[model samples]
Target: MAWGPQSTPDYRFGRSKNTQRYSAPPGVTLLGYASPEGAGDAIHHYLRDHEAQVRRGQQVVRAVQQLINQGITPDITVTHPAWGEALFLKTLLPKAHHIQYCEFYYQNQGADIDFDPEYPSSIDGHYRSLCRNATQLLSLTQTDACISPTQWQCSRYPIEYQHKIKVVHEGVNTLFLTHKHWPTKSLRCSIILLILLTWAKRHAKRLLNASTSKPLPYPSGLI
Candidate 1:
């Protein structure tokens, strides 16, 4: 069971393309969210009213609940930290193992604070506060497993939660990089062909000039 942004092409390219191809073990089931209307509108509606968003999230969790209600217990359910707050898997998924893939905790802890200069201070402050609250909620949760791509990210969690955190290095495939050399070879071939064409053009021009300047051959009968 995986929760977070739904699996789309962009997210697939960003997050899982290489790993899925190279590192993922056989028989791994990648469960992702699917909304009837799609995730964009749902996320937009979620951001507007957090309380309503929490309710809606609970409804989403209930769908998972139905699977468990039918006695199908998944081995692991990985969720993004953003969706962690809305999902109460401890209560909802008591038997199944819950894991969270920690990304960033949104707050003003020395991170850049670039915003629209035209916006009033009050609006900025409200937005900042909302971000802080979301981060706070993410940090407070307890789960069976937590994984981070880097050690630095794993350190961001609370000391108690750190024991549960595991550092898994994301894998990379060199196949694409190797395939890139073929294009470079192709480019070099193209350059060489262009140079040869230029030389041929010059040679043809010289032959044409030489032929035009040379004396014409006389007819043997007239001579």
Candidate 2:
């Protein structure tokens, strides 16, 4: 089942069987109450940020409860914990094994904070980032297992949760990886060369990190 915005056609078309999509309630406000601004409002802003997540989490919990009452019990529930939907699932379905997709963890340095000097960091950015991770931390605690698309992504999580995360690629699009009959030989060769180059870089990075104390290189934000 998919639980997200109804505006996306993919979910509407892909929804099958008794699976359902539980989206946000109408006119609930995008991020809870009105957001606070300016330096003086930093603390207040972060409070609202967390409040928004809790509100969304409540909605998810209610939706799941309704589904459970309908006899639609699942043995395994796969969810992305980024938005707090997976927070209270374990409370309702203690017997069900929950596997959360660990997408990204916010960091103040060397990762998505001051990546570009042009876009300088905000004064309360660090605090906001930490508050943003509250939902993730809660969801991870409730989840039985976790999966990360890359090793680097898994490493971004807390040391406690890191042990539970398994690194696994979701798989690539074969159509994009392989050439079609329409493409010329030269184009196909170039594409293959690009792919090989990317693989070589990743391989080199793995070796370098393994031999040194430095960690595997990851993008400033989500890898």
Candidate 3:
């Protein structure tokens, strides 16, 4: 967890800097690094988030190095590409099968940002939004393959790289739903949009109806 809540300083990335091995899950190891102060706070700089990810990756590299020192090398490495800890991972584990999750790719205009006049997107904002996808693009080259949740979502990626992404939706487990068993947690995973007042007013009415309606009967998870 190089750049998430776990990696925040004064948090799970404790001063101990020790590798966390979970016994309950038996041999499940988790490595966390302290994210640099103000690492993700800036949006004006195009490389701002990417640079932060590289800094966090350095710490992860050191942690993995310790394992390498012990002659412990993994045959596979599952990572979140957006976290930036994956920056130098291929260099470190050249032979490992690396898999990254492919969520929605961002764009400055026509997609999420600059879609409405009420909420104007500045040139800097557009640049930042477009530039934020740098890490994802680099990951496309570095990773062995990718996993996407939906065909429509997978289609959002570049045409050439779409082949690398396999759609694996987390469909509701019907048996589990029938049994009323539900998992307590789901790890990280959204869309952004701008609104015109006319559409917003119509959407609000529909939203109210949706909100008042009963929640979905099924949750995503193991069957």
Best candidate according to TM-score: 3
Give the lowest summed-lDDT range of ten residues in model 1.
8-17
Predicted model with the maximum lDDT:
3
lDDT of 2 by residue, 85-114 (tens): 677778877887788888788777666566
Better of 2 and 3 by lDDT: 3
- Residue 215 in model 3: lDDT: 51
Q: Which residue segments of model 2 deviate by more than 4 Å?
A: 1-43, 173-182, 186-223
Model 2 has an lDDT value of 0.61
lDDT of 3 at 67: 65
- Native-referenced Cα lDDT, model 1: 0.48
Q: Where does candidate 3 have its weakest 10-residue lDDT segment? A: 6-15
Q: Of the candidates numbered 1 and 3, which has the greater TM-score value?
A: 3
Which runs of model 1 end up more than 4 angstroms from their true locations? 2-49, 84-86, 112-140, 158-160, 171-223
- Ten-residue stretch with the least lDDT total in model 2: 9-18
RMSD of each: 19.5, 11.6, 10.5
Could you give candidate 3's per-residue lDDT for residues 1-223 as a string of tens digits? Answer: 2221223221112112443443223333455555444456555478888877767667767776776696666656656676675777789888877778886777666656676565688888878887888887876789888898778668877898888888997666576677446446654321224323223463465545544465533442211
Cα lDDT computed for each candidate against the true fold: 0.48, 0.61, 0.63
